[model samples]
Target: MALRACGFIIFRRLPPENIEFLLLQTSYGEHHWTPPKGHVDPGEDDLTTALRETQEEAGLGLEQLSVVDGFLQTLRYEVRGRSKDVLYWLAELRDPHTTVTLSPEHTAFRWAGLDQACALVQYSDIQETLREAHHFVLKRNE
Candidate 1:
């Protein structure tokens, strides 16, 4: 069976429409940066895992974000010769300047604009997901 995970593609809009995405730097292994995500527990649904992981990893609760519609993306990849599937739900941070508290799993966090976020993640699938989220927000508000 494929390992399943869920997370949010969290972002915030600054004045005059500058949007930045949230990425967390993992403390272990390659110390790569990714969104706040984690493996799903048994009997838990995808969105619930997303919200729970967001809170545990970034200290952002459900009250802090406005979940975006029509913006779910799934990516399938291989990790250590095993199949993995990750689902990402899009959300807009209620406050652009909200504080971010990190858990032990993450050493740092950044709210990066598109180019920086894409550069930080450095995976084609995640970069594409960010693009899709940005496009969805822009189109939704237009």
Candidate 2:
């Protein structure tokens, strides 16, 4: 059985239509960069997991975010001989001024634009997801 997790591709708009994405650097395991996410608890739905993890990891609640519908991305990968499936939903930070408080699980946090976010992230799938999220936001704003 594959391990399943969920998270939000949270973004904020900068000046002149520029978009910046939120990423957390894990304190453990090579400090891998990813959007706020966590393993789904038994009997919990994916979106709930995403929201819960986002709040826990990023200190951003649903009130701070406007979840973008119809923009879910799933990426599957191998972790220590186990298959891991991660679901990511797109969300826009309603207030770009909202402060981010990191959890102990994360040593650092970044709000990076698409190119820097892609370069900072280690996984290709994550980088691709960030690109897709950028494209989606650009299309939605148009």
Candidate 3:
């Protein structure tokens, strides 16, 4: 059985400088850094799962985000020898100043620029995901 998860590639604009992505360090597993994501709960659609997990993990709600259209990423990997698929949608925080309240599931959170985010994420899949999301926003703005 494939495990399904959903999350947001959440970004914030810092005005005249750069954009930053949000990453959370998970308390479990290898303590990997990832955008807020969790297993899709029963009866929840993918988008709903994304929103719920974001709120649950990062304390960000739908009201605080502006969903960016046309950007989605699917990543597949093995966890405990079982295949797992994670889907991520892109979003922008309405206010860059908004504070993040992390759940116990995560040990820390950071809002970092592209290079910093990639370095912190460490995983090739997650690094590429952040790169793609950064380009997605830049393309949209162009």
Candidate 4:
């Protein structure tokens, strides 16, 4: 069976400048940077899994964000030689200045621009995910 995960590609707007994306540094593994995400629990729907993981990993809830509808990305990869599938939906924080509370699963977090976020994410699949999310927001703003 495939390992299923879900998360939000959360971004914030910074006036007098540009949009910034949120990336978290894991405390484990390669200490890689990724958006808030976690494994799906049994019997949970994908959207519920996304929200729960966001809350557990980043302390953000549905009320704290505005889900940007019609934007979803799926990434397939191998984690430790096992197939993993991760789904990400776009969201905007209700307040651009909201603080992030990281769980033990993450060591640090940053709000970065597209270039920096893509660089920090490292993996090609994740980079594409960020790019897609960026375009989704840009298109919405247009």
* CA-only RMSD, every prediction: 0.6, 0.6, 0.8, 0.8
Candidate 4 positional error at 32, Å? 0.5
Between the candidate structures 1 and 4, which one is better when assessed by TM-score? 1
**lDDT values, one for every candidate:** 0.95, 0.94, 0.94, 0.93
**Tens digit of per-residue lDDT, candidate 1, span 1-142:** 9999999999999988899999999999999999999999999999999999999999998889999888889999999999999999999899888999999999999999999999999899999999999899889888
Off by over 4 Å in 4: none
Q: Estimate the overall C-alpha local distance difference test score of candidate 4.
A: 0.93
**Every model's TM-score:** 0.98, 0.98, 0.97, 0.97
| Candidate 1 wrongly placed segments (more than 4 Å) | none
> Is candidate 2 or 3 superior in TM-score?
2
Clashing pairs in 2: none
lDDT of model number 3 = 0.94
- List runs of model 2 lying over 4 Å from the truth: none
Q: Alpha-carbon error at 47 in model 3, in Å?
A: 0.7
True lDDT of residue 81, candidate 3 = 88
Q: If the candidates were sorted by their lDDT against the true structure, best first, what order would they fall in?
A: 1, 2, 3, 4
Candidate 2 lDDT over residue span 68-95, tens digit each = 9889999999999999999999999999
